[model samples]
Target: MYQFPKGFLWGAATSAPQSEGAALKDGKSPTTWDKWFEMEPELFYDQVGPENTSNTYELYKEDVANMKAMNLNSFRTSIAWSRLLPDGKNLNPKAVAFYRDYFQELVDNGVEPIINLFHFDMPWWLMEKGGWEARESVDHFAYYASVAFEQFGDIVKKWATFNEPLVHIECGYYGDAHWPKVHDFKRAIQVGYHTLLAHAKAVAAFRESKYNDGQISIILNLSPVYPRSQEPADLEAAKWADHIYIRSFLDCAVKGDFADEFVALLKEADLAPVTEAGDREIFLNNTVDFVGCNYYQPMRVQAPEVAKRPISDPHDLFAPYDWPEKRINPHRGWEIYPRGIYDIAMRLKESYDNIPWYISENGMGVSEEERFENLDGIIEDDYRIEFIEDHLAELHRAIEAGSPCFGYHLWTFADCWSWLNAYKNRYGYYRVDIKDGFKRTPKQSSFWMADVIAKNGFSREQI
Candidate 1:
């Protein structure tokens, strides 16, 4: 057994919208997700939208019990921002009661709940008011953060300010996948800067709050960006990719500054982040205590002779140019290189002083329907099992070589919802009968995880 350090945190991760259902039952206003799901349900795969998800909102007590059944020591779940404030200010008693009770229930179950403030679900009213692209949205976000921490901080100790700020930029704004879809590189830059400003402000507020037993952090989707080859152009492309993907937020949060080269790129491209005079100083000054890492796969980058402009959907009225480069990942049609995890850790250790980090979100998403069958409902998810084990092995090696990672929280505790993917990409240890009122049935990997948590290590390489 490769013994992990004492008091290592081993649990599963979930976002509120992804796991918690009752998306709009309890006095909750329509977030952008609710609006989108209502307006164009067909936009999602299989026509499965984000209306009523895993029923976690209604079944949280039972869900907590299920976590205990799975031998979880700590659980990661984000708080729905709209749920808390409804309209980011109007107090919703029902939402408060639901979350209060849910968090308390988890605590009673001996499972420490790590609460994140925002998880990709933006309040629709904010969208009408310009969403994340406007300066006011940042203030609104900071206000939401304060409200959440003030209310839940007593019960929830670990608070994630935002779940993957860059993702909300790339997928939501720049890519075609997410809400308020736009492909404006200039807006993307401004939006990223504003989001970081909000994060730093929230972290500062959290430190000032009465909650003393906990810490506040931001979870970023960090990938190990690799050059496609030994060519210098490819290496430069990788560096550019890294700056946009990780360093932009990382340096802002940790060093209280943005990279000069990064700023230069924005200026040279005329896509520099729009910010208030002191925003940079504010973000660089206030730092987080930990990092919530959402590791999916590595990125292979190569310079494009001519990168295309950002692609826009019907929703966005304006657009700008995108990076002049290319990226590829074959496994799963996305990247599947596990060494990215090691590279991320090594970079963090070497550059950022190895600030305390946890793998807040990491797991493999597979089509779960055809995989699980009549073997007493056991999903021989050897593929998923291998994915996690491989990442953990790399993490272990990094730790041995001096990476200050404290814990690992898989992408999910159970299959819930992916903003646009619906139920197509299942990342869960337990399979929920999507039709049977979302009844959760533990997969074969569930027991495997429990044993790993119970013993803190496996007896051998392959269980």
Candidate 2:
């Protein structure tokens, strides 16, 4: 039998724009997502936009009831910055009342709320002011974080400054997946640097405020890098890949600065971003209280076929190699390597002083929902159950080996809406039917997860 520690947190996570509809209601302003959808509706799957999602703004009470029914003791969700500050400088009274009631409901249902400040939904006004690329945006973000602490600090004790900062840097500044897409490597570095600075400033503010004895951290999507073979060139490639993708943020968040080797490489390439006088001191003074890691898969890297050129784009530094023998998720086309999670946990234990971490987001997203529906009007989702079980077993091994992991939150609670994928891939314990007034029905995995929560762990015999 597998047994986790007492009071271990078991729950699910969701972002605001993906689940909460009513984009313009209750004095809410438009975010980058709202503007992006308006500009290019066809970019989204099925042409579904953020204007009408799961209507969580109107149905949060029902959603909290569903969380309690699932035996979840903790729930992680983000407050929309656009909803709270319509003008990006002033707080809306109606939005404050809404969150106060929403957070209180979770507490009333005996569910602990883990509040995150930013989750990729930047207010439109902030984007107009040059977004994260501009250094002043960092100060604005810190001020916004202070306002959130003062407003909701009494009820919420656990806070994450940003959810997946790397995702924003890579997708928005380097790739075309997110809004304000700019494909300049130098700009990407600048944006990433400012984001880390904002996180540190907010952490320093949190410590000074002493609000509810809270802990502040940043959630990172940390995937271990592996060399394609034992060759020295391939191994060297993996090191650079780790520096560019993982360590760029990990070192700053944990060690309070970038690695010297990486800094030298950046200097060599003439790709260093602009840094002010006291920024290093700020990062050094305000380290994270804990770390939130979101692991989904491992990255495989190999030596480039030819000599590398000067920095043209963010991905030009290293190349990703797909191993033919790796197991792939048929529905999502993503590599499924459960051992990667264990590697991440152990590495944290050994490398970064283990500083207390948790799996903030990990789950499977499958397309073609009708194939999984059963005659009982429920999604069988046995594949998803197996997927989660295999990962959890590895996590259990990590815990037994003394990794300071105290919680595991799945990618989401309900299959609401994706950014560009829309509802093409669903990753929720409860299936949401947008056609039927956004009705939610529990999938088989929901009941199975409820059992796992009740038992605190699962046995191989049970599976």
Candidate 3:
């Protein structure tokens, strides 16, 4: 049996925008997701918008109960910026009350709450002010972070400044997957610079505030990149891909500054972000207390087919290489490589001074899970159980090798609404019925998770 260390956290994670339904309720303002749905409803799956979600806003008490039932010792969820400060400047009384009650409920139920400040759900007002593009947005975000710490400092001990800030930089600016979709490389780099600066400012705020005792982190989706061949060109492509995708944010967060090589590349390509004085000092001083690594899959890459001397986009330096022997989750259109978890852990150990961290998010999202339901209205999601076991086995190997991994959290607790994808893919221990009053039902994996958490370990025979 592969056993976890004592007091290791076991739980799930979900963002406020993805789970909390009452979008405009309780004096809350509209977010980018809400505005996007209004402008382009067809972009979401089944035409479902942000308003039609799991209704956690009203049913969080029950949600906490479900989490406790599954033996989850911890839970990670974000606080919607728009909800707390509808105008992005002033606090809303109702929103503050609601969050206090919700977070307190998690603690009351013996579930440690790891609260994230931002998860790409910028208020519509912020977007109107150019969102992350405008340098002033960094100051606004720092004020917001101070407000969160001062308000919830007593209830929550662990905090995250941002979740997957790269997706906001890549999908929202460089691609068209998220809100304010545009295809501008210059704007993307500036947005990334502002985002990281905002993170540092928030960390500085936390350190200066009365809640300086609390731990702060940033959750990054770090995927280990693999080369398609042993050729030097392919190897170089993989290194560049890692620099662009993972190290850009990882190094800044952990080391408090960008790598010299990355800076030189950006300057050579004329893609460097405009920065002001004192920014370097802020980054150099304010580093995270720990890190949250969210690993889902590995990235396979090769040298770009048509390499440009001065790269215009990240794709110009590296190209995706499809592997012949790869298992894929056809439902989500993602490659499933459980070993990536170990690779990520070891990379953090060897490359980042063995910083303390945890698996903040990891899970399988399968579509049409109803097809696996048995007669008793229980979904026989044996595939989900096997997925967790396979990933945990690899995680155990890393832990045995002295990786400072303290916990593992699945992608979500209940199958909450996913942006763009909507409810098309179900990734929860308890099945959420969106059709019938958003009822919650435990799948087979819920029981399996309970058993694993109870023992704090499992073997292949348990499967």
Q: Which ten contiguous residues of candidate 3 have the minimum total lDDT?
A: 304-313
User: Among these predicted structures, which one has the highest lDDT?
Assistant: 3
Q: Which candidate number would show the highest TM-score if scored against the true structure?
A: 3
Task: Give the distance in Å from residue 424's predicted Cα in candidate 3 to where it truly belongs.
Answer: 0.3
lDDT of 2: 0.89
TM-score of 1: 0.93
**TM-score sort, best first:** 3, 2, 1
- Tell me each candidate's TM-score: 0.93, 0.98, 0.99
User: Taking the tens digit of each residue's C-alpha lDDT, what string does model 2 give over 1-463?
Assistant: 8899999999889988888899988899999999999999999888999997988888889989999999999889999999888887889999899889999999999889999999999888989988999999889888888889999999999999999999988899878999888888888888988999999999987887749397888999999999999888888888888998888888899989889988887777787889999999999998888888898888998887764756555455557899999989888889999998899999888889987999999999999877879899999988888989999999999999999899999988888788899898889998889999889899998999999999998887765
Q: For residues 1-463, what per-residue lDDT tens digits would candidate 3 score against the true structure?
A: 9899999999999999989999989888999999999999988888999995899998999999999999999999999999898997889999899899999999999999999999989999989999999999999999999999999989989999999999988999978889898999989999999999999999999999998787999999999999999999999999999998999999999999888988998899999999999999999999998999898889999999888858889988899999989999888888999999889988999999999999999999999999999999999999999999999999999999999899999988899998889998999998999889999999999999999999999979987
List the candidate 3 regions with Cα displacement exceeding 4 Å.
Answer: none
Ranked candidates (lDDT, high to low): 3, 2, 1
**Tens digits of per-residue lDDT for model 1 on 402-456?**
8888888987887888877888877788887779889888777788888888888
Query: What TM-score would candidate 2 get against the native?
Result: 0.98
